[model samples]
Target: MIGKRLKRLSPAIGRAYIQLIMELDERISEISATQLQKQLKCGPGCDGCCIQFSVLPLEAAIVAEAAVAKNVNAENNGESCSLLKDGLCSVYEVRPVICRTQGLPLAYIDEEAGAIEVSACPVNFPDDYPLSHDELMFMDSYNGRLAQLNVQYCTENDIDCSVRIPLADCVC
Candidate 1:
């Protein structure tokens, strides 16, 4: 369904969406290689955090297109993400931004607390592990860029940017 909707949109918008995701993936790779690889416990077959979630229309469209191309069907086990098959993501290559940064040192502003908080998977990092500012992946910057791209895509495609589509619906 999302693929069909994307067909009517401008190809340029699609390219931009893909470019943003690619750039994010590259950043994640660089971080993993330079800093997080030793502490990162995430790897294939570790689907503990593969839970169901919603995504923006631009993200849904790209994931849906990839699923369609790969002839993969989402199987909702009612406990985890529909995109997971045999404990691995069926559409791993084109997964959404959130999935790309899982288990990494994520930093975001805690507005209510008026400070920045950094977090990572407990299994990946010990409770006493000291997180460094330089190693933290500040999410706000990337999320802001994604929001900008999403707005452009949604405006052109007539999608409600505020309405997030479930990940399962993307595959369907």
Candidate 2:
């Protein structure tokens, strides 16, 4: 379903795409928390999943912009994440989409299996609460949009978009 004009969109498209993604992520998180019978266990100072993770080039660039704006020089010396300062994300406001969705119940369609798989952080859903596909954040759509935006970005810059860099590499 590629549009005629979007095949040549600007690199700044990532900013807009990421903004919408984050807003939807927030709404999904809120909905998940309300639908679940238990409270979300993740909170401030919970840096357990903030380890080494790879992000798309567009995502890394967006995070890097936020880090620069906030003057967040946490130093990415190859330790987990460069944005982490004493177990707290220095660029929390502009954290990547994955960071925003951590610990939340979500669903992704297993392309090969042709089935929807729902999951969340172990700390969450401890009671084995039953959740339907609609009740969870469907990641396939959001991820597709992100990938599309990345392609547009790469095409605009004449670079390969498939490369994913570590979070530390971006923040530093």
Query: In model 1, which regions exceed 4 Å deviation?
Result: 1-9, 110-114
Candidate 1, which ten residues in sequence have the lowest lDDT sum?
Answer: 1-10
Per-model CA lDDT versus the true structure: 0.83, 0.70
Per-residue lDDT over 26-99 for candidate 2, one digit per residue giving the tens place of the 0 to 100 score: 77766765756454777788888888787877667667667666776656546467678888888887677788
Provide the lDDT at 158 for model 1: 78
Question: In every candidate, how many clashes are there?
Answer: 0, 0
- Evaluated with TM-score, which candidate comes out highest? 1
* Tens-digit lDDT string for candidate 1 (11-106): 887677677777777877877886568989899999888999989888888888888888888796787999999999999988888999889889
Q: Identify the leading candidate in terms of lDDT.
A: 1
Error of 1 at 130 (Å): 0.5
User: What residue pairs clash in candidate 2, if any at all?
Assistant: none
What value of lDDT does candidate 2 attain over all alpha carbons? 0.70
